[model samples]
Target chain A: MLKELDPLLHSQLRLGVMSILMSVESAEFTFLKEKTNSTAGNLSVQLDKLSEAGYITIEKSFNGKKPLTTCRINRKGMKAFEDYVNALKDYIKK
Target chain B: MESENKNLSPEQSLDLIASMIRQTQGNVSSGSFYFLLWGWVITLCNFGMYILAKFYSPSNAAFIWTLTIPAWIITMIYASRQDKTRSITTHLDKISMWLWIALGITILPSWIFGSVIDWRVNALVLMPVGMATFVSGIIIRFKPLLFGGITFWIAGTLCFIVSPLDQYLIGGVAMIFGYLLPGYMLRSKK
Candidate 1:
């Protein structure tokens, strides 16, 4: 029996974001965009979906005059990511 | 990356996870500046004091180590600048920073109190330094730093039987193994 893949994390961009966030304590919006190689508008949308699903938290503040956005994976997100990886492993074994 | 509708196979998902984790791990490049800076500073101070002790009065020789105060101030400035530019903060980074900060706090008091009590404290100071480095290595899973930490502990133990001046020499050699060598290796790895 194979575990079901996480709907929230099955897409390319969303999974990429989760993967990056899972490894670090926190990352800036720009950092995520760069790592994912996604446009700002596209990355922002994916981040919003992840944030809405409670898989991550987005903090918006100011660094001097410019707005700073940082994202961190929450407990739910970590568990979901771990489960997703385990599920992927089960699929790969078959 | 803009194709949001594409579904990945399990193999692709695993590959993505591995790649992202590698990318995040690669961001740990800023540590070399600190290691190199402090390594050179302390190494120079130790050797400088050793050389000065031969020709200068003891009081003058003691003043050489005070260079660390300015070096520390500069480190603070450099660290803040680096921090401002960093886009990611990992758990390991925070733990490593706090461990070194803890070392600084303990070392300062030990140095001052040792001087006041007329006891050589290089050996005493190295013990905590070893602990900090060892634990940091464990956090980062870096073997060189783990070995470097052990080297400091060994040097500190050997210091107990040596003269105060020789302790400076030992400390310098220890820093070479513990900080400079590992520091350079980390830089190259980056």
Candidate 2:
């Protein structure tokens, strides 16, 4: 069955972010920024969309009082990605 | 009721993911400084003492090890604390970590099963580490690690060929070439 797909996650930038995060245990915002080649404002907006859809989670804290932002992939997101890939595979298989 | 804590920002979603990953790993950023510093010291000293002892009698080697066990035991009590605070903080770090650990596991047993500690055991350890790295490199395709793993595998085989006699200098050289140097390369890397 095709699971409910997230439109936010469906976008290129957000999709790329999730793809990378899916492979990694977690990553920092700056790392993701460099990776996706997305500007700060745009990446921030895209991440907000994914976060809204329950696909990924964001964290903020201080490392010796300097703020650090970290992101991780969640289980629901993993399942979704696995299903998405499987669904995508169906298209590819034809 | 949809109460005060409303929608999360993109950052918050990222944070949730981070927390979940940490939960799976069960690593807490609660390491003690003294212990980490001591681990650095212990490993370094062990490397040094073991090398120097090869020239002398087995008894002499025993003397060189006088403090290592105590230090290792003591430091391990607080080792987990140090593990968490570092980054390479992503899951990629975890892969690197297990690669390093598997190297230790394979080498440590052979090192312990010592009549003379064949250097070839290092070669055996290299097989998995190399394959993992090479495979991962192709998939994620990082270059240096792939190269490094292959290099270590080749060098490890050489170590075994000339072993025991080669134990002292070659072991030192392989680790320097195989691990320490590569580790530095990875650390200073972008």
Candidate 3:
């Protein structure tokens, strides 16, 4: 029996965001947009969804008068990402 | 890049994760600036102190080290600029930063108390530096820095056996091998 793929992480942008977050301590909103090649609006929406699901934390602050957004993967998100990768491996191995 | 909302197959998802990891790996910025800057500065200070003590006067020669005040100020400015420009901070980067900061804090007490007690503090300073370099190398998995750290330890040991003034020469050589050489290597790799 195969594990179910995480619906929240199955999409390209969300998966990309999580992958990037997993590799770093944290990343700025601009960085995610650039790395994922998603429009600002689309990236914001996906980030909000991930934040709502407790997969990531979004911090909004100011960097020298400019509004800054930073995203970090929480422990729950890390576990989910790991489980997702294992499930994906199970599917690919067959 | 694929469309944001599109569903990905398992293989595609794995590939995406692998690629993103590679991208982050390559994003490690150059650390050569700090290494080269401090390497040259300390090397020059050591040699300058040696020459001054040999010829003119040993009384005020240590004052040459005061130049480090300006060097550190410039380093701070350079570091702030780099931080502003950088897009991501990896776990390794954070660890390296804190390790060096801890090293700096250790140096303060060594300097103040060593001078008061009239103790030779070269070994005292160099040991922490070696530990910092070694740990940073382990964090980044960089062989040159790992070797550089060992070089510092060896030089520190030699300082105990050599005459007081010769420690300056040994330290200068150590900076060349331990910091400048590895610094250039890191720059080229970057």
Candidate 4:
């Protein structure tokens, strides 16, 4: 059974972003930027795409005058991850 | 079954994920709280060693007794098996769990080699260990693990600074700060 996923999360960068977010309570923008090895512009674009898909929630705050962005994956995101993994496994199984 | 799947709002999604993580992680290390409760016993013994060493030749018996890497490893294994189901939440739990593991690994070698190697080198052990934990935290974006790793690195810093002239103090500090506090947090998360 295939679980339909938001198109936004399907791309490799977005997928990596979601995977990283799924593994933590929350993460800062700087941290995520470094982890995914994506430039700020690209990561910010992917994150906005994820947020738009309702797969994640983003909070913008300032840490000592510097902008701080933190993100957490939502329930839909979690299920999507499971469903996505399952779908991937299905392909492997075939 | 198809109807069971529905689009969730971000808040709802996060709630579901959080619950899944908790359900799967389901009390890592059954006796962790109890062991942590008794962690003070180790602290007390470490203190007793410090006191005794001040008055006598460096204490070996108590120093040897405080080696905890094996116990830490056993505890880690026990904790990891607590969750079998793989989910996004469970995956994150695995990340934090590995934080504790890397912390253990950081100090383990120091304890094993402290006697044979220069005590000065024992202090250096924290750099790689701390860096590993810190980088993992950054990569995974796990703040709690980051906090734990910071604590380990700070404790490691202390050990590195003082191990040359003082070993038991470092042990005592590591017992209280490194092991006891993080263990409490890991168990207390409900």
Candidate 1, residue A91: how far the Cα is off, in Å? 6.2
Q: Return the TM-score for candidate 3, rounded to 2 decimals.
A: 0.84
Candidate 1, residues A1-94, lDDT tens digits: the string is 7888998899999999999999898899999999899999999999999999999999987766878899999999999999999899889889
The residue pairs in collision within model 4 are A74-B13, A74-B14, A75-B13, A75-B14, A76-B13, B123-B160
Q: Which stretches of candidate 4 lie over 4 Å from their true place?
A: A1-94, B2-48, B57-59, B66-70, B73-77, B84-89, B102-107, B119-122, B125-151, B163-167, B185-189
- Model 4 lDDT tens row, A16-83: 66767766666677766665566888778778878887899998766446666778889988887878
Q: What is the Å distance of residue A47 in model 1 from its true position?
A: 0.9
Better of 2 and 4 by lDDT: 4
Better of 1 and 4 by TM-score: 1
DockQ of candidate 3 relative to the true structure: 0.60
Model 2, position B76, has a per-residue lDDT of: 61
What lDDT tens digits, residue by residue, belong to model 1 across residues B92-156? 78777888898899888886777675648888888898898788678767899899899999999
In candidate 4, residue A29 scores what lDDT? Answer: 73
Please state how well chain A of candidate 1 matches the true chain A, as a TM-score: 0.97
TM-score of each: 0.78, 0.50, 0.84, 0.43
Off by over 4 Å in 1: A1-6, A60-68, A86-94, B8-12, B51-55, B59-61, B131-151, B181-190
iRMS value of model 4? Answer: 13.9
TM-score of chain A of 4: 0.90
Q: Which residue pairs in candidate 3 have backbone atoms (N, alpha carbon, C) closer than 3 angstroms, thus clashing? A: none
Quote fnat for model 3. 0.69
Tens-digit per-residue lDDT, B129-157, candidate 2: 55654544443344655675576577656
Best by TM-score: 3
* Superior candidate under DockQ, 3 versus 4: 3
Q: What TM-score does structure 4 among the candidates reach?
A: 0.43
